[model samples]
Target: MTVELCAQKAAAAGATYFGVEYYGECYWGNSINSASTQQNANLCTSYCAGNNRQACGGLTGQLGLYVNPSNVVPKEVGSYKTWVTQGCYSDSADARSLPNTYNVPSGTATTVEICLDAAAGFKYAAVEYGKECYYGNYLSPSASKQDSGCNMQCAGSPSELCGGGNRINLYQNNAYSQPASEKPSVGSFSSIGCYSDSGSARALTAGSSTSDSMTVEQCVKLAGSHKYAAVEYAK
Candidate 1:
């Protein structure tokens, strides 16, 4: 079977570790960051497009998916390592958010969490998978190719798989291996968040309703509903 098909199969089988293909050589994603892989993916895309092909093969380049044997986690923890196919991070008094498939839950629990430790003045964090990126402070994304040796790739849509809950900001050196429920102090008020709290808290509590007084989870839950305008976390 082709490497792409193999990748799909491996993903279905719940593999965590995988290798990337580029220019007849293999690159380990877990050991490398997405940037390198992204460059390789770009090379492949260009090579394939030039060859008028849709997939990789029979060409000098055109990255093929690599298959590895590792368990996939609901979310990443401690690191946004190259091997990690996907994840989220952020920096703020607010709790970072992952997609419903990662940490930020949706209609159902389809994801996991990797709550990082809180620190002082952390300014940046990154969430990546393959070549896709979901990083803190990542506002607008532009499509581009990555360096070689890695098989990552990005299509340039921040919201495609990187944004939710009013945009989270991942901090540096933060590490949490537990679920998001464990941290009730992330004081973020997401525009698109999980707000299913007090049956009465749905609507504006009063003329001057705000999230500054609410806990992290409470603010998130409030953000999820249509009643509240938006949570305003204090600076």
Candidate 2:
């Protein structure tokens, strides 16, 4: 069977390791059983019949084994940001329609967290229609868009919005929020951890309560009572 089919079979069978041999052969097993035979990824040079761009298995006597990263928790690359709306990163419509199933099947990821985890191998992760995930090394600046258009709710989590048609929510592990070197001024607020500073240089008005279970909204409201421009909650 094809490499894609093999991977699906392996996942369905509760196997953590999937291997391909001789371009057409597929192998599946758990990590404990395949550790001894693990080899460098370079050795797996056989091109898959289903897709020429991806390497499937290895030469004779060599097995191309891949570890399933479904259960692995992805590192917080940093903050998330919108990428595209009403447009696609590539010209191919199929890529826009089926980000996970097109070209080569990446996997079935239904949530943002799962999509990010599946896309760990790539520099960027994108989600569409709340059920599809795509990975890429780079994104064109021309595909930028506002977050409003990408308001489709994720299938796994109704509260979280994914991307709508022709739209994609992009995220990167390297994305980080840069702290402002200086404080905010009037008509602005500084988001320092869970607290927000109203840009006032004034000392935090005399009394501030320390609560272990305080939300940002509560903190902001409390700070407003004292006519203070800043609210800070310490752990």
Provide TM-scores for the models. 0.26, 0.32
Give the runs in model 1 whose Cα sits over 4 Å from its true position.
1-36, 45-53, 57-62, 66-71, 74-164, 167-169, 173-235
lDDT, candidate 2, 34-106, per-residue tens? 2343355566788877777667767767666666655332221234333222232321344342234322223
lDDT of 2 at 146: 55
How well does candidate 1 score on lDDT at residue 168?
Answer: 32
Q: Pick the candidate with the highest lDDT.
A: 2
- For candidate 2, what's the RMSD? 14.7
Give the top-scoring candidate (TM-score).
2
lDDT measured at residue 13 in model 2 versus the true structure, 0 to 100: 90
